[model samples]
Target chain A: MTDDVAVLGAGLHPWGKWGRGFVAYGTAAARAALLDAGVGWREVGSIVGAATVRGGYPGHVAGATFAKALGWQGARAASVYAACASGAQAINTARAQILAGIADVVLVVGADSAPRGFFRPADGDRPDDPDWLRFRVLGATNPTYFGLYARRRMAVHGDTADDFARVKVKNAAVGALNPNARYRKRLTVEEVEASAVVADPLRLLDICATSDGGAAVVLSSMEFARRHGAAAPVRIRSVSTVTPRFPNTVLDLPDIATDSAVAVEPSGETFRSSIARTAYEEAGIGPDDLSLAEVYDLSTALELQWYEDLGLCAEGEAAKLLRAGATTLGGRIPVNVSGGLSSFGEAVPAQAIAQVCELTWQLRGDAGDRQVAGARVGITANQGLFGHGSAVIAVR
Target chain B: MPRVLTPVVSGWFAGDGDDFHLVGTRCSACGSVFFPREDVFCRNPGCEGGDLTETPLSGTGRIWSYTDTRYQPPSPYVTSPELPWRPYALVAVELEAERIVVLGQAVPGVTVADLAVGMEMRVVPGVLHEDAHTTWTTWHWRPTGVAG
Candidate 1:
């Protein structure tokens, strides 16, 4: 494993549907991070931004956009866009800069003022664009894909709707304790059952909503952290950013068809499983090493899928682990102590960073109500559109 | 009323009855086959450029998975706003020869209740929608014993 970089600070602008520009949220988050790090804006040697397409031309140049918003101190700037994986990618960018000796203290930020409702494609029909084609041809909204997966699990693994609801129930309880979560109210399986169906077999409560939010992290080399008076800090051990191997047949989001496997025998592991496996190998840790986990729960069923993919449990045993309370607080490996996307909704760029923020808090023993006691290591897993893998392993 | 004959993607399938076949391109190098046709560069990272020859896909495949879309899909998928929504079954069929899974709407009158894992089905052309002038065509999965 590469030497870890200390997380000097973490900040967030509580997730919600606020009508403000992404820059505003990102700048606010950056300022909060600076204050948390006990450093002035000028002390930041670099700025890495996770870009949002919602911001028009400025978003394409996100590092510069956030840098300008925070008042440019002539800091080195970089911007990255990897769909939902943008935040982790931004973190990866900053980590590289620090490791390369390009920067002593780097600021990484991801914020978005998400649009309302089912995320529609950029207007107008272009059959060539897969995102639009799926909508036009199948009316396959994001939830539709979620629904498909939920049903597939049900058919193949015998997972029931109640099992899906338990995920929301577990996550919402943790969210209730998280001041930064969009939904603080605890949920019940009955409530999930009563909720309207957004997609068949996936209720409204089962899916994450769109929201506006921001998250930022202050990362620095270990020497810089100690010199700056942080005797001990949460260190990021590994950041996995992998691409899918050919012949992926899972029919992922915004795609019309799976890759033809006729040419190549498919890999033994699915893309998601491969993502976590890479991180495990890079960090020299196994699934049993995890103290807690924060996985992208775009839908409740997807969270269980992560349990298997992360190797927290064997295949088709995610629901069993959940029911056995192994994944809840005080269990073998608590998950989503930050409420997950099921509670936070999805601000795309901000969510993954928020996962890291939760990891930082739990590892530091500062997680108030949802604390995973004596937490030493945590992993945040997320997947991006097209084929992008994102997972970060953090240890105290 | 008129039945529209079309493939959502052109040249994916042709002919009728027992002679029906699903067409895909086979890469001369690395022997990788692509459905929906890859006209430009070959996607296999390991292979150099190769001629993509059109080959007929296997006529039958087993169902990998199935689900029904209970809600109406959003735009580009044409449907009359005045009419009530009708849910349709979608199936992922695994073709053994292509070693790939292709998804399509189940033929009319088929529902999720009628499908099971590993059930055999064949690709059939179906009409998506129609206006006074143009009819949108797409592929549908029909059980072999079913009569249209």
Candidate 2:
């Protein structure tokens, strides 16, 4: 197993359509995390910022922007972008700095002020770009892909629309307790059924919304944590940032076609499963050892997909696990106790870090109403566009 | 004004009616195929390098999955704002020979109701959008044996 980095502090700016710029949200979350960590801004040796594409130039160089906002004291800085996995990439960057002894403490931040309605490609006609081509050629939006997955599960695994609704119902119930969540009201299956269909087999309620929010974390070396009197801080044991193997058979976002398996046989292991597997291997732990999980629930149905991908259950048994209440709080293993993206919507760059924040909170027993009992180990899984695979394992 | 018919993106597909097929590139060394036609290089990691040649994909495949857009998509996807929005069905078809899944819009009027996974679908040419001067053409997927 790799050397562990301590999660000294975790914080968030509540998610919603707050009509503010990303910098404001990110700065707030960073300040909160610094306060929680009991560390001064000048004390941080480095800063890593997860970038957002929509925020113009400042968003691209987010590390400097955040550093400047936090009153720079010559802290080394880095910025990264991996679509939805941007936050995880930032965390990994901080962990690397801590492990490499380049920095004793690193501040990692991610935030986004998302656009309304559907997430669209940048304005202009660049036929060479697959993201633009999908919209121009087929008018396939993000929800369209979610619908395809949900329907595929129905056809292949016999997952019904009701099963999909149960995920939202369960998450919303827990989300109601999370002050950081955007949607707090518990939903019913009837409500989900009555919602407008954004994509077939997936209703508006089944899908996550785009929101403006931020999340941040403070990472430090184990020695640094103990010296700071954080004697038993929750530690990050692994961060898996993997890419898909060649001949990726599943059709993913922004692509019109899957890689042909003519030259190479399919790996059988999907990109998502491989992400969790890599994390498990690195952390020297397995799914059975997990106290809880925080997966990218872009859609309620997709959460079920992650359940199987994370090895929380066997293939085609995600729905059965959900039906058995195994994934709900007080069950064998609770998933998405932080309300997930279903409750938080999506803050893009901030989401992966936010998942880790939730893990830290749960592991520390700081999640009051939504805390899992005696939570000791947690994992987070998410996939970014264009073949970015991310998962993290944390232990208390 | 008379309208001109043009492919939305050139070199991705060619021909007419039943003769039409999506164009892809095949690696001479690795035999790997790429859609949206990779012209520069082969994507296979195991192969050192190879010549990528334009190849026509299979005319038909079976549906891997299907879904429909119930809401209007944002800009860059041309639509008539003056007219009421109409949703369209999209299908991901798994080609048997090349072992690739290609996605396309179903023929106009075909909704999610008519589609089922594993149903045979064939690629056909269709209009993506029409302007005062030209009709932008793209590929569509239709169930095999059904007349369009």
Best by lDDT: 2
Q: What DockQ do you compute for every candidate structure? A: 0.55, 0.90
> Model 2, stretches more than 4 Å misplaced?
none
lDDT of 1 at A73: 94
Per residue, candidate 2 scores C-alpha lDDT tens digits across A61-179 of 99999999999799999999999999999999999999999999999999999999999999987988899999988898999999999999999999999999999999999999999
Candidate 2 CAPRI assessment class: high
What does the lDDT read for residue A48 in candidate 1?
94
Q: Model 1, residue A93: what's the lDDT? A: 94
TM-score of 2: 0.99
* Cα lDDT computed for each candidate against the true fold: 0.87, 0.95
